[model samples]
Target: MDDRIIASLETAVGATPDDAVLRVHLAELLLAAGRREEAVRHAATALAADPTSGPARAVLADALDEGAPAPQAPAEDAAGTGEGFDWSRAEQEVGDLAPPMYADGAQDPQGRAFDVEHGDVRLSDVGGLEKVKERLEASFLAPLRNPELRRLYGKSLRGGLLLYGPPGCGKTFLAKAVAGELGAAFLHVALADVLDMYVGSSERNVAELFRVARESGPCVLFLDELDALGQKRSLTRNSGMRTTVNQLLTELDGIGRDNEGVYVLAATNHPWDVDPALRRPGRLDRTLLVLPPDRPAREAILRTHLRGRPIEGIDLPALAKRTDGLSGADLAHLCESAAEVALMDSVRSGTPRMIGMPDFAAALEEVRPSIEPWLETARNVALFANNDGQYDELARYLRKRGRR
Candidate 1:
């Protein structure tokens, strides 16, 4: 089958000598067939015709990754008659064959749909974080669903949200839920995406990201562990980090006023580590701290996670009481740990059935809250949080706890 695909690709390339699109397609097919060396040659040919062909460049990069040799022009045949190909005509034909460029002047071959990935934790899948959900609904969902309300109020909804909390407390999960709720194109911008070792590349990538978001309107750009990109300049020796942050700040500022449809959502465990400028009024204005689940929330989380399992003898309320100071994620982990115990029991006792209370009780020894480190950061955030400031909600939560 691979040989057939490669043969067809070769035939297509030969027939469409000047067609860059065909060449690129052939390159993709070759790459898929593990013919990296051949793919590189085709990609190089396509790029030679259309210098701005991103797909060809991407294919070339993949080929290079597989140690493919550089492409060279073929020598004359035994006929000894040098049939000089019209390079300019080939270039024009390839250029014409290429797909329409994005409004941001970038070639996105996979299109907007390419941004969506397979694995995603939906809002319904999340066990707890009721307050977090309500806040997101009010801030994000409400604004998106009722655009007219925002227009009447003369407020342009912009400047993405920042979710800061302990690890395993559902910050990332909440970000995913927001994307799912909005039904918008979700782009997870990794720290590496915006951070480059090259001098201006980091800044350029940041600008390109916002540009992509604008072109793909009603999109959500979720920057996870945003502190890596938005860290305080003083804390880093890498000049690239500083440049990236500056670029992000500029993009975010413009996005607030210009991007009527694009939404930016970022998550970080160490909010204090983030640059102060980013947390100010214009960048990530609305910050939400996802705390560990309370007793009621924990019980609800357990029940949600254990919905399909046969737990006839289990008492969720009692388990919730035992699991105090645990986050929603922690509860989920607990359920998983219990399931592991049940599996072990099934293997030992030959009864592959329900997970009893003993399984849960034993799992408790292994599952623990991941919120301790964030507690210190939350304390610092609380100190900076003024009554009238944007972090008032976070401040209130910390103050109520009183321990720090």
Candidate 2:
């Protein structure tokens, strides 16, 4: 066997790793050259790619004829499993040859389908929104904290709480804080995590999602976008989506399932778009409105985003006051814009300077409130669609802000 010919073939196999025929040819050449170990590796990879390739199988057997075992495979071919081919060990050895199949939601170390995150953010970490906190305490937290009082008063933990507000107002963060307050695991899911193209798959995902929450008792299953997931069934055209909604409803109702310790929290920017069935008595019945951060919260958010950045003469209170309608995300963008202005100035003038009020003023002119359109839609819902007074809280906020 010529070494140059073998090297060229090896390079060709490397370029097209999935080409089983090319790999078999290279393996045969390597085997003829008495490089049995390398031959075995290439043969195993070829077999993995095309399981039905008899040539690859023949070459693999021939390479391992005189006690030359597979690379990373055990000395005993059986691996003590009474099987001819130790596929599990072979997979362990050649796993890197092929990428893992399929990408899914958060997985644990043991490769469990769903990951239950231990909550680290307590309600105290959430700045401002004292009124929203008070509502949570009254409706959800206080009851859970006092089981005896809850039992005596017949306060069954049957329904989950819904958080509705403009986007970027920290609804998801608020739900995590609620989880932290309970010292439970947090399972944050979104629309993409559930819906599948195949029939019945979406429903199964919904079921599995609740199953994980139930197993991780005292867990907060925070559904990020409820409007899309639980869209009004009448309005939704796809039968798969409608069935998915039904599955979610069944899980929320705790039909034939224990939900005592599973806390469900859902958030939506357009609550009006959510299925009314989802808001029935024993579902996501309770609603909480999450508005833009108040002054204290604005100051805290600004300080948080600007903590590590070089700054001088940054009046946080004044900045917060000026950013009245901006959401937490908008505030973060403002900070980034301010930093960019300072960076550009340093780059142009060849002299570095700390970010000052002027940088923030420049950022302010660019980064306006992103939630105005959301507020306008909400105002329409509050005024025209408040037949059940579900959006009364929202209407009040709009009226107070003169958005009504």
Candidate 3:
């Protein structure tokens, strides 16, 4: 039977590549022969050739279920056997078999939907960054909820907010928390999403990004690793990267003060690397430095992360003091590493149980800070200080440390 199926596939491949029916038949044969992965490839090719091909789609779905834990009804159960179920032909015969049309009209599929998308994280879940949270709430959440306050201000809220600091400092997490606090839609737009090889496609993606945010009012557009998209063209030799930055700038500038209900929250490790135009007043006006957790903040972070874990008495204050330069994310990772050490110890002793202080200390030694290089670069950028009060606190911290 396997040989017969292989012969059929060879014949099908020899035939025109556009033969959707033959492709589906070959895929089905391959699936029955236990070549599930190859079956999926053939089925996908068939679907690409004729998107409306129901038999091909059914075969592809069946192929996906192979070796998967979940139980799925066989194609025979769904469409019946020995009938050569051609969905395209069936749709043509019975007009009602067409694809469902959405009432919302044509729009960018990736865009935020105000009534649909919501944040996954809450302020309570954040565990630390109390001061930062309070500041953000005052600036964004307060004005958003109280329409009276906004009216009193008279001017519509404008520009984006940038969260810049060391990696693992909870910039992205804070953005999510803000979204949840405001009860607004959260659309995280990464640099990869807007990148394209084709001309105009990159710009189109940027337009779509802002367009979706506008359509979905009361939305938070979170751009992560923003330096990738907003990088200064002077540093890059690639015209494509420069074009992408220009497109981003144009989209940002287009969203003026009048565009209320849509908020842009961007995060970057290297704020200085971003184009000056993007950092201008109407673009990213509010630049919040999300620094590494201070002594008190670090203690809170350690306690929060270690809670409910089977740990042999941890002196959190001592730990916090030791982890002076660590970010919230770094602390979390350190805790994870400690847990792994405990797991290894348990396995060695043939007993699985709680982690001890020694385990944590050992893990701390193994897992050093990941942001040292980035921090050094940031220090260099800070040398030619524009005297923006934004850097005062960070500058003070750096001056004492003496540049990494």
| TM-score of every model versus the real structure | 0.65, 0.75, 0.69
What lDDT does each candidate get? 0.79, 0.91, 0.80
> Once model 1 is optimally superposed onto the true structure by TM-score, how far is the C-alpha of residue 161 displaced, in angstroms?
1.7
lDDT by residue (tens digit), candidate 1, 49-68: 99999999999998887784
Among residues 3 or more apart in sequence or in different chains, the pairs in candidate 2 whose N, CA or C atoms overlap within 3 Å are none
Candidate 1 deviant stretches above 4 angstroms = 1-114, 117-128, 255-258, 307-311, 351-353, 380-392, 402-404
Model 2 residue 100 CA deviation in Å:
10
Worst ten in a row by lDDT for model 3: 108-117
What ranges in model 3 sit over 4 Å off?
1-116, 255-258, 385-390, 402-404
Using TM-score, give the best candidate's number.
2
Q: Per the 3 Å backbone cut-off, how many clashing residue pairs does candidate 2 have?
A: 0
lDDT by residue for model 3 (1-404), tens: 77776886768687778888888888888898888988898899989989999999899888887757977444442345645556655566667655644446557465443233675678877655777877787766777778897899874577889999889888888898888887788888888888888988887888777788877778898998888988889998988888888878877777452346778999999887788888888788878888787787788788888888898778887888888788788899989999999888899999888877787789889878887887777676666654665566567667878863
Residue 155's lDDT in candidate 1: 64
